[model samples]
Structure formats: C-alpha cells, structure tokens
Target: MTPTPDPPATLCEAFQRTVAARPQEPALLALAGTALTWAQYAERVASVAAALRHLGVRRGEPVALMLTNRPEFHVADCAALHLGAVPFSLYNSLPADQIHDLLANTAARLVVTERRFLPVLHAAAAGTSVRYLVTVDQVDQTPEEGVLTLEEAEARAPRPFELAAALDCVGPDDLVTLIHTSGTTGRPKAVEITHRAMLSQLSGSQQVLKVTDQDSHISFLPAAHIADRWGSHYTNLLCGTRLTCLDDITRLSEALALVRPTLFGAVPSVWQRMRTTLEGALAEADPGLRALAEEALATGRRHAPRRWKGVLTQAERKELDGADAVLAELRRRVGLDRARVCITGAAPAPEGLQEFFHALGLPLTDAWGMSELSGIALIAPPGMPRPGTVGRPVPGAEIRIADDGELLVRAPFLMRGYRGESELTARTIDAAGWLHTGDLAAVDAQGDIRIIDRKKDLIINTGGQNMAPARIEGVLRESTPLIAHAVVIGDGRPYNVALLVPDREAVTAWARRTGIATAAPWDTHGAELAAAFAGAVADANARLSRAERIRVHEVIADEWAPGGPELTVTLKVRRAAVTGRYADLVETLYRRGAADR
Candidate 1:
C-alpha cells in the first residue's frame, strides 16, 4: 500500500504553521531558567540563517552539529533548514575519529558546537572540509583561536531575517538530517531522512500521541539520536509541543521534578533504575505503608487489563481507584504524575517492564523503530499497551512478517537512503520498497508486533543505547598490545562488559615491569595483568559514551588463534562463538556490576 502523504510540503512549512498558531506560547525552555516563545525561537533561527547565508551556505549544503540538548541547537538547525541546507548532528559521545569520518562523509564545512565538544571537534575537523566552527556556549567570550560564537552569528544578521521569503528555498524531497547508526557489519551508516518523511512521522505520531501546544516534553537524549529529533524536536515544529532542553543526562531527575512534563519518554535503563529506586524506598518504608503499597500494586496488576479494555466493573474500578491513590505520591515524586504517555524505545524493554509502571499508576508504552524510519513507526498504543508487544504499526505505516520472521515495514516516514551508500540503500529497501528491518518479530492476531531477537550483531544496552561491537573491539585492540582479542558483551544488559584474550608473551613482558612471575590467578602477577587490562579498557572507554563503556572484563587465560572456537579463519573474532564459549564468564562479569568501569 502507498503510504499517506504529509499534509505539509516540508518541515519548514509545518514549523511556520506551528509558529503562527503558538507564537506567544513557550516553545523551548532551558532547565537553567531560560525560556523562548515560538516567535522568539523563529527570530533566533532567522538570525542564524542570515549569518549562515552570509557565510555562503546554500541549498543542499551540509551543516554538522555537535551540541548538547540546548535551545541554541534548535536555532542553528532551523537556520540551516530554512536556508535549504542539510543539518546533521554527530553523537556527542563519538570519538574524534568517528566524528571526522562523519564530517568528511557529509562534507560539512560548518559545524555548530559547544565548548565541551570543541576539543574533539577541532581534532576531528583536522584535514576535513570544516571551515567554520560555530560555538553555541561562551557566546560573548573569546572563543578558541579560530571559532565564532552563537551570539556573534545572530548579531551578524545583515537585516531582520525574513521568514516568509526564506521559506521558498526548500521542498519536501530535500534532505533534512542524517541519523548515524551502526551498520550490519560494524561501520556507521548515515540514514538520510527528508523533510517529507519526518513530517509524515510527526503526523503518524500525532495520531497516537495526540500531542499539542498543551503538551510539554523533556529533551534528554542527544540531538544526534533520532529519538530526540522525532520525539521532541520535530514534534515541536508540527504539534506545538513545548520543549525543555536538558543538556546533561545526569540532571534528568532534577529537571523532571522542575518541569513536570506532560509527555515524557526514556530508555528502558532509566525506567529500570526508577523501578529499582522505587523498590528500594518501599523496602525501607514503614511496614504498614509498605504492605499497603504492595497490595495496591497487586490489585492494580489484577485489574489493569479490565481498565485497558474499559470493561472494569464498579467494584474493580473502586479497587483500582484505591490503588491509584496509593501510588499517586510515588508518581509525583518521580515527576511522572502528569505524564499522560511515557515511552521506552531504541531497544526492547526487559520483561515485565511495562507491568511495573502500569501497576504504579503510570502508563509506560514501548515503541519500535530504527534510524531508517525516522522514529516511532510502530508503537504500543497508549490506550492498550500490552507487555512484550510494540503494538500495531502507526497510522500510515504498513508492516509484514516475512517467512523468515524478519519484520518488514513500508512507510512514508521511511528513509530515502544512506548517505553516500547507494548499494547499501538498495540492499536495505528491496524492489518492493519494503525495508527489511533485520529484526525477528511476530505479529499477533491484533496486528501487534513482538520482537523476538535481532538478526544483526549490533549491541543495544539496557538503556536502549546502540553501538557497534566491532568498533569497540577495534579500539580495544588499539588500546593495548597485551590484548590478543576483545569481545564486547552488552546486548540487552545493564552495561557493557568484555572478554579480553591476552597475549601471553606480551603479558609476561608487561609483568616484567611490575616484577610478577606468571599470569596465574593465584599469583600476585594476575592482579598486575588484570590491572593492565583495566587500564586498556579505561583508555578505550575514554572515547565512548557511558552506555558504551565496558563495566567489567575477564582476561582469558587461553589465547585465541585463527580458526579457533572464538576466531574465524580470517582471524576475526567470531562474536557469537566467543560469547557462547564463555557464557558463564560473561555472566560473572555482569554480576560484578556496572560501576567498576
């Protein structure tokens, strides 16, 4: 079936519509007390546009962004968009090498960034096409030797930037952004999404979310990720949802309490941590109150199905009402009391994750989508969220389960192609136009989809964070000569851990420095080797995100060789074979916990 066309010709048009409707409404808010009305945001965007236009930026040009979740990011991105330029964001956690590769691929001459990322940006910009480094923070202060500031850009506007005339620069087919994600084999693939596709996704999301100017959202994820762009940023342009920019993920708790967002979403790890905290507090509460809370949750679980079906009897409704009363305080304390719909995406939620929240008077809906689809293509309908299933395809998306169980999707929001990878794009979307999602999934009678397993080798951590294991393993090999081979393990786990095969000769040589005898666990020499492995792991982790860092590692006493159980004939690490052989060891590594990294 042909997917529905977006009502707006382009995202620029949708944004203008929203601005007209909510000109005076709070469009963007900073956790630090800065707020911008829609009109003000448009003004700032136009100012940036004038600056970029002056800098010779034109239609189809790429403008890279390395920013935290800040309002300035919105301004810079919109400025690029209205100028008919493509604005793509690089993951803030990406190492200098990866950032450089992305910049080279996009040929982005201009990059809008902040001080925190300037060092990496400067390093990455070396020998690349980058000519302008626009800093978001330190607006009026002296920037790095050759960088311009965000305020300077706005001040350089030749005249009041005209939004109306500038809107004519681009159309729906124009590329909007490039979402960089892990490819099937380990390299990063930049998924190309156009304005039309994103607008379609926003429309489909609106059918379920029903979001409007009344809705307020917390921007927690990096703008580089598709979830943040689709869930918060693009939604603003189409639905007039207010955005609270949370620059630092660590401060999400305080920001949540401060903003009390009406529509919020987080990865499973965040929800899991909340559950742990809630359980820990309940364990320490007064005995009588704790008992009441447990009983209320139990009652809630028993009748939640009836509530979802809207067939709850009077007695059942009263019981649930009491349960709601019992958990209301808990909800408010977590700043989720006002949340009409909460979502978990990027990875499958752990079993019973949905039940825990539903029992607590909160509806935690799970959705499934990838970078290629823009976002939120398949969502567990908030009205009837079922455990384990990511519900039916959203309006305007068609889904089918292939004979091999691979989930296939066709939607207006689907990506046009990968940036500079036409062959890969052709492989992903076949002649029929169905995107092979590479996920093993099942469709129930109700058209709900339950993801069973992944067909690819990418690792998605507990917090719904995705990373390429091959990239990490490559870094590990470079981190230290003592490591013979490194197998990263963190698929659906709380954090990353690694199995490191040590080169015996190299370990023994390194042991000479520490005056250790053998690499035996009983010997003090073992501690020295473990410490060495730890150091290498730390070095590699310095280039990764918190979610991608290896928490614990086990140095394998046995060295791996080509064609061995853990290695291919080509000397590559056979990931599944290595993990399968050391399943117990990997489990032990995770049991050591996520803080040791």
Candidate 2:
C-alpha cells in the first residue's frame, strides 16, 4: 500500500486544502438528489462562520449542535472549527434534562437546532447560560427574543467574512470537539478531543483503511457517536471522500443501495440483521437453489482464512474461484458490491458473525475503539481479518493488558481529558499517560486482541460461576435475526435469564410462514411467538456453556429503537436502563424459576 502524506497541522487546514484541490468534486449529498460541491460546502461553512461571528461567537466558546444528519450539520460544524470554537453534537434521542446537563457542563450559550426540538431545548435552556436558539428550519422567518432561523443569522452577517482570520488563530492542541460517551453506568461524560488527536488517529487509521478520494460513505448513525463523526465528517474533511448524509436511520437499507459506498461502517447489530435477512430468504428458497447457496458459503469460508494468510492451494484456489462469482451476486443484492472495506465495532459481534460475512465474500472487519480515543484504535487489517479478534493496534496506538485484564492504551489519539471533570479524568488516565480502558481483554500470541467484556459488566452468579454477558448476548442475537436485542441478567443471582426483543419483520414473516396468524394485535406473549423464541433460545444455549446459558427468558412486547430507553443512538444496548425498566419482570422471573415456563 502507498504511504499517506503527512497530515495537516489542524483539520481546518485540511478542509482548506481539500476545497482548493477538489472544488468541483461532490462533497456533501442528500437523498433527494441534491449535491454540494467542495466549493459550495466551503461557501456554506464561511457563511455560517460569518453568521456565528455576528452572533458574538468567538474563539474558545462552545457551540452545541442538535440536528438531523444533513449537509447543514457538516456546514455548521466546519464553521465552528474554522472559527477556533469547539463544536459538539448531541444525540437527538437525549432528553431535555440531559441536554440541560450538557449545556451547563460545556457552558454553551448557543444551540443550533430545528423547530421540532424547540420545546425540549427551551426546557433545557432554562437556568443555564444558553441564550440563543438558531433553527435551521422554522415556519416563520421573523426573529423572536432569543430564537431565529439560520437564514436570518446569515442575513445579519457583517460584510467581509473574516473566516481566514479566525482559522489562523486555531492551533493543534486547541479543543476541536466534545464527544459524550454512551453512559451505560451513569451520566454521559464529555470527552475533550483536540485537533492533534483527531489528526493523529485519522492518519494512523489510514494504515488499515488506506482511504482515498475515490471512496464514498453513507451516513445514518448519529454524528454524536465517534464512529459516524470520523466516518462522515472527519474523513470527508481530510480525504475528500464523498458523503451522503441521511435524515432518518430507519431508511439505512434504502440509502445503502442508493449510495453503494466504497467505505461502510456500522455497529455489530446491523451486520447481524443483514445476516438474518439473507438467511431468512434462503430458508424459504427452492431446495436446489438453497443447497447451491449453502455449498457456495461453505466453499467461501473454507478458502477465506487460507486466502487471508495468502496460502491457497491450487485446488482450493479453483474452488474459491468458482464460489466468488456466486458470492459476488450476494454482495450486490445486499448493496455492498462497491464496498472495499466493511467495518463493525462499538460492541462485540458473536464469534461466527464475521465468518458469516466472509462466507459471502465480504470481510466483515472487527474493530475496537472508544470516544476517549476519538475512535479506531485497532482494526482487522484489510483482506487479512481474523474472525474472533479485533486485530492489531493501528499505527500510533501502544496497547498492553493490565494484571486484572483491563486494556491500557498509550497513544497519540488519546483525548486531552474529560471535559469539566479533572478528578475523574485523573482517575481514568494515569500519571504515566496510559488511559485505563475499563474493557477486559486478552492479547493472543499473534498480537490480536480479544475483548472479553467491560470490566464492570462481567456477570458472576451467586454460585461463583463467571462469564461475559456480551458473549452470551451475542450468541443469542446470532442464533436468529428474529431476536433484535438481548439483555442478560444474573450478576449475583442463582442463574441467568434473558430479555429478548424480536425483530418485527422477521417475526411476522415467521408467523406467516408457519400459518400461526395473530388474531388481534401482535402479542409477544402469544403461545406461537413464545414457541419461536423458545426455539431460538434453545439454539443459542446449545452453543453456550452450562453456566452461561439462559435458564429462562422473557420476550419484550414492544420493539426497541435507537432513540428508545433500551438503546443508545448508536444502537448499543443500555444494560442498566433495560434492567431497571424491567426490574419487576426480572424479579418475577427469578421468583418463578425456569420450571414456570
């Protein structure tokens, strides 16, 4: 692979270079067939920067953004960066009070949002430093006391935008953004990322991705999440990658087909859904066709590891040669035909999930990172992915396993510190500069890292049997696509039980195929639905050890979505929230043993 050139001193400089180098290239895209050229994107950023200056925004001030994934978000965020101001995105799913905490913590006085979120923002802004509500879209163009549309802000801008002057003041160590972690344990803490750290991590990640201007990305996940921020915004700023930002994540499948991006990244759940979709369709296919597809998958898997090692025999090479053609069609059907690299991280995927994608000719790369590192610390090397491990560390990351199995990282990508929490930050990052990542991990002799679980999330039963809840949950999700989410419970209990949220589409299809039609509203407690879940749970348990298996399970009645109580915007399960929300149900399951089922 060719070496990447030296990274710019700051992202603002990188953006300037990209705009000068590829002015006519498509930079930002929308689903409605709208495109913004690199020059137009830069123009938008300048306009926003001018408007911000007019509103009294200055260097070192925090600007909070709360909006959907659109070209406007990129424009506004880049505007803040150029102004030497810190720009941070909030999860649209966050509650008014959480927004209150974030604004108070950042001491941000301005919030960029649309009219839909005004009610929530108004409540959050009370008794805080928040003084302005700049809406991207509002019904009335007229300005209110503390609220105005984006157009009005631009209209009030002073002549001769001093964007260049502002950019000149920015430095490498200056704070670029504040990314809040998905607080599974407590309140989300804002991670302070600097220009130097973002640049370092991005350049290091290129060793694995080798990202280039020819690449394209479709953005659906929340920009608040580090993964999407890096994939959609940062990559485009530095590498000139084309970006298609979607407003709604539910339409991700439709957008994927439309963009057919060269680079695709998602949480492990998305890959599981794709695996299930193809498997479900094949389950009902003609016997001959099903057999042929199965044989192709088997052949692909048999050749994948050998090919990854560059050790294919003549006959094995011929077998893969035949299977790849069939697998290529499958890739096209799933809208990954143009994909050069597919990445999955943010959570653990079941052991076989990666191999499943490899069996279809796409190497589903396992990755590992966190908000503290600004994402992508370790990733499976392109074309040489290992199924069960998040591969070797990227260029600048130095990793070591602590005595108690916690992973410690010393990297240029490390965050400056947690925002407004110096004491907590001191506890997290030791005096030696090694960030104590609370994840339990084991590094194999090959230098590949296998994440066991979060150090605090491991379950130890009353009888002293210990296991990782993530591994069990992963196995359950992989047993069938019908199960969308699984929460395992047993910390100090006698045995484990699970709460399963089934996929509505997959479950409906299964019910139709089995002729077990619902008489009334869809009921998760219905005998037929229970039977289906029972089968899936049994299948999953077969793959787990006796201690790790679920003794009893309850299927969730309602579908859990990204913005819901059960899931973070990035689609990671909020274990505490789920367990707390269903405390009564969990207690009931324990009171009435597995015999009750």
TM accuracy, model 2: 0.95
What lDDT is obtained when candidate 1 is compared to the true structure?
A: 0.80
How high is the CA lDDT of each candidate model? 0.80, 0.87
- Report how far residue 476 has shifted in candidate 2, in Å: 1.4
- In lDDT terms, how accurate is model 2? 0.87
Write the residue-wise lDDT of candidate 1 on 530-555 in tens digits: 68778889998997777778778777
Q: What TM-score would each prediction reach against the true structure?
A: 0.78, 0.95
Q: Per-residue lDDT for 38 in model 1?
A: 90
Winning candidate number (TM-score): 2
Worst 10 residues of 1 by lDDT: 562-571
Residues 1-597, candidate 2: write the lDDT tens digits: 999766688999999889999999999998776579999888888998889888988888999999999888999999999889999998887889889999998999899998888889989999999889999886454556899988889999976465566557999999889998855664789999999999999989987899999999998888888988887799899999999999987788888889888899888878877777787778888988788889999999878888777799999998898988878877887889999899999888887889988888887889999999988898888788997799989999999999999999999989999888899999999999999999999988887999999999999999998899999998998887778889999999988999998887777777766777655226877877787789989999999999998888898877787766788776778888888899999998887775575
